[model samples]
Target: MSRAVLVEAPRPTIAAPAAAEETPAQRPSRRWRRAVSPVVLVVAWEAAARTGLLPAEKLPAPADVVAAGWRLTQEGTLGVHLADSVTRAAIGMLIGGVLALALGAAAGLLRLGDDLVDPPVQMARMLPHLGLVPLLIIWVGIGEELKITLVALGAFFPIYFNTYAGIRDIDERLVEAARTCGLGAAARLRHVILPGALPSIFLGLRLAIGAAWLSLVVGEQVNAQTGIGFLMMEARDFSQTDVVLLGLLIYALLGLASDLGLRIVERRVLTWRRGLRAT
Candidate 1:
């Protein structure tokens, strides 16, 4: 018997199921979760103040702090103090950060540099930079110089240490691969070394910024004429707990602002790391 010719029918292609759309209410957002802690703490604080469990003079309610801050802001005192503090912090961070980057580069890239530079840095880092406030006042005369210098000193070590570690920890195989491709020392460093170490460098930057603020707090105490620390101190003297808390809140806000700025910078610079983001 002759085999019958079979005709094939085209198979249908299946489409992927569409993902469910989340309504505004159902959508998962970080904003609400972020507000949760602050809301809870504020509510608890308010309740405690109202109940007299925590005296207003001692802790002060959130509303009282807000009112105090508003009063100072309107008087322009808070604005001036905030501006001075920000300026000092910015100047100090720049000075310390630049120097640390240079030193870190030397120690990380050159054996001679490492031998000469690392030992002193390691030793100097051991000393409590904050405690040097008294010495700084004596030497720098408790002026802007003292605050800037202290902040610089505080910011320096973290940047240097983290940068050195980051550079040293780069994968050798990548460097070797670049070398095998006839990339010169400078080329290898620019293309391979820096990119690999960027994450750690950003981490150092965040830490350095935080340290700068901490040092500023201490430094501002040394005969500070105008700054957030000064504002807090004046409030403390008058037993204005609300104003003191407001000053602290301002400090926290500044630190938060700086850290957020750095995070944005990190995202821009570390685009290759975008792949690591959750889908």
Candidate 2:
């Protein structure tokens, strides 16, 4: 008994906690899984076109669309049209984005600004911006100005609405806390307000990008020159369904790419947020 009292029992071995199982959302292959349905749909479409179930004239086969794209590429026309479209989009986005940010900030931050700005913006937003194409044509003519203006209009409303909403929706307690911490108005805005509103702003940006593309489609179709929309219109005149479909495909791809890029930026910028996971 005395010898046992002098010795301490060996400590129980503790196995390291088993690693948590990876969920589908955590898997690297999740992105590839998302592509499966689209791939299947495309394959079914190709099969339908080959079997004459889907008329080629009505919706050209994917192969024909690819061929048309390759032909355009060979002729060097695709590069020019692509460049022109990209340039217009870039310029319009820049102009629209700047105006939206400035006005939205003013409206959101100041009571007088909100009273003055929100009413008119709300009224203007109610009018279908796309429906203003005729007025835009009259004001600016069917040239680069018309296209740029249309795109800018399309890009403006979403950003303006979202930015105002985002800033307004921020918790007052956070602002109060910043004030209590001896932070001035500018510091509070930079540290607390902008970060809190970023998610909504990004959402608005994505919507604006889509709208810009939609406006560009209409703008290019109306005008007399180089762009995917113009190419599609020209192909329509010639009954070149393949080329028309190819143009549509290009637009879809561009929109998708832009959204994807924005998403990456949003993720990087909002890393501090624990926002909902797709699961």
How many clashes (backbone N, Cα, C below 3 Å) per candidate? 0, 0
Per-residue error for 76 in candidate 2, Å, reads 0.2
lDDT of each: 0.89, 0.91
The whole-model C-alpha lDDT of candidate 2 against the native structure comes to 0.91
Error of 2 at 277 (Å): 2.2
**Native-to-model Cα distance after best TM-score fit, residue 148 in candidate 1, in Å:** 0.4
Candidate 2 residues 1-279, lDDT tens each?
A: 355557788999999966566677767687788899999999999999999999989987898899999999999999999989988898999899989998999999999999999899999999998899889888999899998998999999999999999999999999999999999999999999999889899999999999999989998998659999999999999999999999989999999999999999998999998754453
Report the lDDT tens digits of candidate 1 across residue range 1-279. Answer: 999999999999999965555567744575577789999988999999989999877898898899998999899898899999999999999999999999999999899999999999999898999977778777888789999998899789989998999999999999999999999999999999999888888999999988999998888877899999998888888989898889888888899999999998999989888443222
In candidate 2, what residue range of length 10 has the lowest lDDT sum?
A: 1-10
> Which model scores highest in lDDT?
2
**Number of colliding residue pairs in model 1:** 0
